[model samples]
Target: MQPIVHPVVGYLCYAGYVRASDGEAPQGELTVVAVFAAVLPDLIDQPLWLIGVTPVGRTVAHSLFGGALLVGAVGLLARRRGRTDIGVAFAIGYASHIAADIPWHVLAGDYHELGFLLWPVTGMPAYSGVKSLGTVGAVDITTLWLEAILFVAGAALWWNDGCPGVEVVRRYVG
Candidate 1:
């Protein structure tokens, strides 16, 4: 999926959580932060790869352990600041990124198997023997179409629920 789609999925996950929470709409900041956290694991591990800390950082960032740590840290920080709700919201949002990616991974034939939920520990490349989909030549029209459908669905959900992104887009278009 493209970068934009990732955040939309994050928002969807956040919305589901909020609806389950107080049975009331979540605060705007919580939704925004959840979407932010969804992509944050990637940002943290990218620097390590650049510095030669690992062979490649993709798996590291895409690991469940990494997500757990981020959640723990966020929870701790929020507790310190007396903002526990924000911390938990971020954690769920971040994990939602993983959840969102899981289906795509399987549909793509478990291409990033090792980096799936049990990566870095199992040492098994989920798609080790399979042809890699991450390669430039591997991307094709089919993948694009699938991603486009998912994006459209996300947009519809966001718009129906009056998500922040919908309002932002409305403001700009108007």
Candidate 2:
């Protein structure tokens, strides 16, 4: 998925889960946390791979083991700080990111592309020789269509949820 899709999906997932669980939209601050967590895997892995520290863009941070460890540690710390909601939001966002990456490979039956879920246990697939970050931002037609669909769905959901987190960004920016 493109970088933008991940966070939008994360927000959609978290907001839907919150509304279903409690009949209340998520708090803006925690929604922000969820959005950040959604892209956290790529944030960790991409830089390392770009710097030649990792063999692929999906390494430790993209693995189930690594993700679990990160979420668990963060959850525990959040609990200690009396912020379990923030922890849950983070978990939802991170899990949504991993889940979002799974479908196309599963549909294509390219199970090997999913080996990164297990990291060292299953090993990551070979890198595709993509050297520059520009490749990630480039939008081909298929990706553009998918992104458009996701954006519309996410926008509707965000509006329905009272546009949670918009105030947070406005505050930071202004």
lDDT by residue (18-128, candidate 1, tens digit) is 889778655566777887887776677658768987556555666788677768888999999999888977887788777765665566676446454666675634233
Candidate 1 lDDT score relative to the true structure: 0.68
- State every prediction's TM-score relative to the real structure: 0.71, 0.85
Evaluate all candidate structures by whole-model CA lDDT and list the values in order: 0.68, 0.84
Candidate 1 backbone collisions, by pair: 113-126, 114-126
- Name the runs in model 1 displaced over 4 angstroms: 50-52, 124-143, 165-174
Q: Model 1: what TM-score?
A: 0.71
Candidate 2 has its poorest 10 consecutive residues by lDDT at 127-136
**How does model 2 fare in lDDT?**
0.84
